[model samples]
Target: MTPVTYATALYRNLLRLNGLGYLFRNVSIGMTDHGDVRNRGFLLKIKCDSVTVLRNVRQKFKTLNLKDKSVARIFCRTLHGSTQNEHNNNIHDIDYITFTNCDNDTCKILRNELLLLPNFVSEEEEKQVVLEVEPYLKRLRYESSHWDDAIHQYRETEKLKWSEKNAIIIQRIRDVAFPQGVKQISFVHVLDLKKEGFIKPHVDAVKFCGNTVAGLSLLSSSVMRFVNTDNKAQFFDVLLERRSLYIMKDTARYKYTHEILKDEESVFKGKHIPRDRRIAVICRNEP
Candidate 1:
């Protein structure tokens, strides 16, 4: 890494390290009463690259605090590149990452970048449900409230979790994304793609009261192309390393359109990456 790169990484590392022991001193009252999630403007830049590996730091919550309704935190980890077989049937091979159990050392709770199966159904069950649920995806429109029919809502946690395995996968996603349990995080996950490939030049209208961050959990190596809308040829590419987390927020979200290349192979970091049947878990949260 060059001196400039090292300096940028140090700046980001310091931002996080300061968060470790620093307490909010001001008695602020607006959206973020504690000023935990800050809202800065566009053109924000972060320097985490393709591959990253991390362990859920074992945090001992004070005796379950039955009085405490809930707590939530998200750690950005593992963005390094790894080769994946395009023919590998194991869907797990596509994404590489895990989640922390918030509390640890009880029963084994397998972590994942997306589906952290917590006392839930098996992964095979999840596959079957996604198969059935996918057909309804064609009906997923911008006008609707969520992914379900006229009878039910896709955002309902309890009702859907009991039956549909897709719902279970979705529930785990919600747990990590919107653990706060009120209002929705408002996200979208596109699994099936055009025969050639997929992604659109689009910007989601965000109505978050706090600093909203978009987490892209890539299950396979795919090229997410971000271009300066103002200058079409002035583009950037991100090789979403499998099982790692990619975040887009602030100015990046508003200024660039993240598009997935359709062709089987795309270039990143001076290396070529091939695409596969990919699944991405888009995660976020709110009050």
Candidate 2:
């Protein structure tokens, strides 16, 4: 049989399985040659909402008969929440913060002393910064051993030096995002997230970092959500576009718990915003 026909048959078989019809409807199936003329393979990519669903699907998938069993593979991924619909139901009461411009006064609607600067750096400048920091990023691991339990599926490093041109860029960021009189830390923190990585809601440790936290987003866009620690129903989602910078201080920094949602749960203004590998250059003042 042709590859397409085989793939269709496999998809049909999965859909016909009892108790999993709803899940099979969302499964993505395809066939690939892996750029090799001799080898052909069938790939089944399953996105499940919970670990229980994934376990059930895997056990069922194993029971299916395959013409070429050696070449058939099933890959299952469980996102933080299974589907966008599930996420919407949970966040129906949360508020969203839209970006108008870089003006601090206009962006303060979300919280006091919170600001987002869109396109903080030009494309060329972003490339230069990425090139300068690429060495530090290379050493990152898929899972970071941070003391905080809130971070997951992330790689992070701290650097104290930069090239002359990159140093100027950092200084420019400090001038724009940070308070002038405050003593900023010399080292910069780099946090890289895998496509499926996410940050759970948590406040930054006051002992390790100070009142202000500024970050420059790179590689991909994501929604940074802030929820009031005292009020669970009160929250805001801030879209952090690529190359944009965000600063949080005072009430926004201390009174709100911040988190980065997983790709499946990343929605802003009622639209799904798919996420990919993301890197951020973070700067903070002395504690």
Candidate 3:
């Protein structure tokens, strides 16, 4: 049998073993075999609505002991594209605050200080921002090693200049989030997180930045968890959707430690939040 045919058979058998044979009706699988047998490669694509089933399939794939044993890249696409716009519109009008058994006082404090605004920028503006800063990010190496042990598997750069259009967007964020008398930091920070990257729980150094830090989410969605510093039991999760803006100020910035959870641990409202590549544009106030 040809290599493509063999791969198709192998995939089907594995799915059946995992009790996911029913996915065959919803999933479309195709393969492209390179010319040489020894150097041949193939691509597998699966489309399904269930994140739980996708996680199970991924776990099963990880059990495969191939000759190379290299990691397989999985890309997820939402089936409902038309509802995305409506979803953005709805989130834009609402403020989402979730707490885990925290006291009413603490929850009220967080609710007042933490703000998440979805669809803060249009799709075209997000694209423009990415296009402007991607070249700088590409030049920098991924910061896997750090002295402070704060971040993991990310690339970051500070940009002082922005295009005229981008500058207007930045100013809007500043006017909305930060107070007028405070001195804004001169440069904007661009951070790119890998698919498997995460930010450990830590507060921003007081000496480096002031009470307010505003960030614009791009590319992917993620969950930012806030843990009370004095009492670890008091914590909450904020869902940061793409094209959304999050502002942490006063109590939310100083009283709590914030971190971006890894994909495996990224669950909000009992649903798994799969993270691909995420880019955040962060702006801060001078200390």
TM-score of each: 0.41, 0.62, 0.66
Candidate whose TM-score is highest? 3
Evaluate model 3: give its lDDT: 0.67
Query: Which regions of candidate 2 are displaced past 4 Å?
Result: 1-111
The TM-score obtained by model 1 is 0.41
Model 3, which residues run further than 4 Å from truth? 1-95
Over 70-170, each residue of candidate 3 has an lDDT whose tens digit, in order, gives 21210001101112322332222123446776775664454346656666676888999999988888887888844689889999888888898788778
Candidate 2 lDDT by residue in tens digits, 1-287: 35544444334333322224355555655555443222322344445555565554444333322213322221110011122223243422223354322233323323235555566666777899888877767875689534677878888888788887678667756654453356888899988888889999999988888888989999899999888787766677887888877878777888889999999999888898889989899999889
* Native-to-model Cα distance after best TM-score fit, residue 20 in candidate 2, in Å: 59
**Which of 1 and 2 is ahead in lDDT?**
2
What lDDT score is found at residue 3 in candidate 2?
51
lDDT of each structure? Answer: 0.35, 0.63, 0.67
Q: What TM-score quantifies how close candidate 3 is to the native fold?
A: 0.66
Query: Highest lDDT: which candidate?
Result: 3
Q: Give the TM-score of candidate 2.
A: 0.62
Tens digits of per-residue lDDT, candidate 1, 203-246, equal 55565422233333333566676655565655555556544335
Residue 210, candidate 2: Cα error in Å is 1.3
